[model samples]
Target: MTKPLIIGVSGASGLIYAVHALKYLLAADYTIELVASRATYMVWQAEENIRMPAEPDQQELFWRDKAGVKTSGILNCHRWGDAGDNIASGSFRTLGMVIIPCSMSTVGKIAAGLSSDLLERAADVQIKEGKPLVVVPRETPFSLIHLRNLTTLAEAGVKIVPAIPAWYHHPKTIEDLVDFVVARALDTLDIDCIPLERWKSS
Candidate 1:
């Protein structure tokens, strides 16, 4: 059986990135092991006007509905509530992991080897196991402290991808922008899913 790809959603503003990425990954038929931080639920309600249920089953239903993925597609997903889940261990092999909209606080925690939650612990496992770990931070006007922490992660072999969309694609809508970032993340994971148009010099 193909190992699943771990997708962690941290507390960040760009919940759409995670939603779109989930859809694309499911469409590509990759089994997903998903975990969301508590803050992710709050931000999803505030930013996307979508409320996620606290229960794992309800949260799975919520994600499937929001991503417009069919029931079978969602069947390929395995949801975990706590950081101590199986994926948090280095022994659990996976294709890789991506933490979309990774909050700066989460970044700092991962950088310092602090696995306070499943998201952070899973990321830590990826790093220690020498697997592809892509972190997409959706913050603007990064402070020096943020830069330093990001650099630390980079030095430790983490792919720090910020959610900065390029206008070169001439994005006409918000979804386009979200696709740009998600596409970059897929690229980093060595996944062949392209959610947006690639830049080609004319």
Candidate 2:
């Protein structure tokens, strides 16, 4: 079974994107190595209206109940310095990596080759190893700094997927829009999915 390394940071504003991605990936039987930023924990409270759980079991339960994600034990959380972790090195053999809601700080770090944390280290390994690295940045009103860093990462072969939801799908709810971007990201990883919409070429 081919498992992709999935990383979620707080920088993604539309938390639903990560949740939906998690749901689909797990359902597809792909084992994921997930890491959440400190800020991501706070954002779930401030934006998505979901509170952080005290225990790892509670965390898994919260995600399962709230986002319909499937996982056994503490599949959703990993320590920052757990370099002992499997996803930390290129030798671990992962198909790809995705950093949903990647922050400008993280983007710049990855672009410049900074691996202070496991998340950063994992991203570096992806780039150095020439594997697919997808970054879903949720910020809007792009600053020139953000654009340049993104372009740099893109040039380095990272898929800088901005969190811009497609309107052509005529989304009735927020979930529809979220699924659209998530499906697109999954597509980059070559994961077969019933994409949120079918394109009609004229």
Candidate 3:
């Protein structure tokens, strides 16, 4: 059986990053274990005006429609406060974990090995298992404390993929720019499911 990847969506400005990442991952038939923090829904509503259902079943359906995945791949949506989720254990055996739009608080908690919830617990599992852990942080004007927290994560073998898009992609629309960051985030996990314009020197 193919190992699934754990995707933890935290409260951040770029909710679409996780959306686009899911589209590609599903298209590639990669099964995913997904969990969204409480603040993620708040940011989702503020940024996209869409209310993410808190119920597990409804949330899975909501994600299905969002990613346009009718029946391609498996997406197991775990509840936010469920600390007993399977992904929380290293024995669960996963490909790795990616926290798209990871909040600074999540970063700090994971960096400090503090698993206050299932999301943080899952991420900590990845770190302890020495598996791929990619974090797509969305923050601007990083304070020294933020930088220190990020650096601490990086030093612990976490791939710190900031939510910065490249102009070299010559993006013409918001989706294009969003895809660039999502593509780079997947690149850290060596996943090439989604296509993007790679940089070519002039």
Candidate 4:
């Protein structure tokens, strides 16, 4: 069986990026191991007006019934709440991991090697295992601290994909902008899903 891709959603403003990533990955028929921080749920509710249940089972039900039911591919989702989950260990192989809309705090914690939760621990495992680790941070007017921390992660082989959308595609909708960032994240993972128009020479 192909190893699953781990998707970690932290508390960030752009929850739609995470949503788009999940949808595209499912369409690509990649098994997903998903984990979201409590703050992520809160941000989702505040920004997207969607409430994600805290329990792992209920979270899966919510995604299956509401968020991802339309897709034909198997979700193959396994949700985990604790940091001690198997994916947190380097022994558990994965296709790699992406933290969509990664919060500044999440970036800092992961950069400092502080694995207080499953999201952080899983990312730590990815970095230590020499696997692909993409972090999509969604912050504006970044401070030096944020830049330094991000630089640290980059030096350690982490792909820092900020949630900055480009207008060269002449995006017509919010979803287009969201997909631009998601496409970049997918590209980092070597996932073959193009949700946006690639820049071409005129």
Which of the numbered candidates is closest to the native, going by highest TM-score?
3
- Which regions of candidate 3 deviate over 4 angstroms? none
Output the lDDT of residue 173, model 2.
92
What lDDT tens digits, residue by residue, belong to model 3 across residues 73-104? Answer: 88899998999978888899988999998999
Q: TM-score rank, highest first?
A: 3, 1, 4, 2
Best-to-worst ranking by lDDT: 3, 1, 4, 2
Residue 162 of model 3 has an lDDT of: 92
lDDT of 4 by residue, 1-202 (tens): 8789989889988777877787777767778888888688788789868888877767766665554646545553334357778888999989999998899999999999998888899999999999999999989889999999999999999999988889999999998988888898888877877657889999
Please state the error at residue 158 of candidate 4 in Å: 0.2
* lDDT string, candidate 2, 1-202, tens digits: 5555655554456777777777776666666677766677778878967777645466666666665655532255666556567677778787788888788888888888887777888888888988888999877788999899999998998887787778887899988888888878777887765456657666
lDDT of 1 by residue, 78-133 (tens): 34457667888999989899999899999999999998777888999999999999
Give candidate 1 regions above 4 Å deviation: 72-81
Q: Over the full model, what C-alpha lDDT does candidate 1 score relative to the true structure?
A: 0.84
CA lDDT scores, all candidates in order: 0.84, 0.74, 0.90, 0.84
For residue 90, model 3's alpha carbon misses the true position, in angstroms, by 0.8
Off by over 4 Å in 4: 65-71, 74-81
Give, for candidate 2, the lowest lDDT window spanning 10 residues.
67-76
Error of 3 at 172 (Å): 1.3
